[model samples]
Target: MLGEPSYTMNDLFAQLGLDSSDEAIDAFIEENKLSKDEKLVEADVWSEKQCMFLQEEWKKDAAWAIVIDELNVRMHPTA
Candidate 1:
């Protein structure tokens, strides 16, 4: 039986319409990192498209929500 995954960082990149290459993913992670001083939902860093995708997935609260939420935390690992 299939189950929801704890998506890898590359999986997140692909899902988020980004280059899934290791270098690109690494660069994206480095570039989009929220400071230990900032928060994810409050940050204004995401592009319009990125924000839309995240908001839609979050509203659905379905298949991608867990993965998306995980990605959210990874993107903002602070208060």
Candidate 2:
């Protein structure tokens, strides 16, 4: 008997209403369980490649500032 079909990165992106951008893709990968190398190949699901790319790209962008600001707000509601 045939089993269920697997999902590719393209398939996932469509389902999540996300583009192949670094940020969106990375978030999805992190939420799911995929690896960088794994993503390169045709897998049954998303891969960590998105996360890895984001980790490096985020370090070079202002995203860290936003994260820090959010954390501060959460920690110091009155501040």
Candidate 3:
């Protein structure tokens, strides 16, 4: 039997209304990276709606927060 569905980078992308494919996710991360001082929700790469979602999920430590934090780390490689 299958356990709970796991949330991953692809899931997070889909939640944000982005291309959720592996290739698209890789290309997007490569193309849009955050500087050491930049916050994930404040980055120019996200739309206002996307930013709000991220911020709310993170603040609430919701189920999506884990994947969201992972994305933040990946986006801030310089940090």
Candidate 4:
């Protein structure tokens, strides 16, 4: 039988650019009060929220960039 994928604190810390020390990771986990069994559930929800926020922000920024580029091109047509 195959086992489930597992990640260490170091792997997560490196991915998040956080301190790799046990104390730092432990404090983060405790502050969030994440139980071992519920960790995946909480992380999934958090990931979804972050993805939504980024999508909205990216849409806004892209719209602004397009508008700015159009205005610049109109102001300097031969550039």
Ranking by TM-score: 3, 1, 4, 2
Q: Which stretches of candidate 2 lie over 4 Å from their true place?
A: 1-3, 21-24, 27-79
lDDT of 4 by residue, 4-58 (tens): 3444545545544567687876565455443334423234424665435434534
Q: Write the per-residue lDDT of candidate 3 for residues 18-76, one digit (tens) a residue.
A: 99999999999899998999998999999999999999989988778899999999999
lDDT of 2 by residue, 1-79 (tens): 1563544444434543567565765564455443434422234442467444434534664434344233223333234
Please report the candidate that would top TM-score against the real structure.
Answer: 3
Q: Report the Cα lDDT for candidate 4.
A: 0.44
Candidate 1 error regions (>4 Å): 1-8, 35-43
lDDT for model 1, on a 0 to 1 scale?
0.70
Model 4 stretches astray by more than 4 angstroms:
1-7, 35-79
Better of 1 and 2 by lDDT: 1
Q: What tens-digit string does per-residue lDDT give for candidate 1 at 17-39? A: 88989898667666787877764
Ranking by lDDT: 3, 1, 4, 2
Q: Assess each prediction's global lDDT (C-alpha) against the native.
A: 0.70, 0.43, 0.91, 0.44
Clashes of each: 0, 3, 0, 0
Q: Largest lDDT belongs to which candidate? A: 3
- For candidate 4, the 10 contiguous residues with the lowest summed lDDT are 68-77
Candidate 2 local Cα displacement, residue 49, angstroms: 25
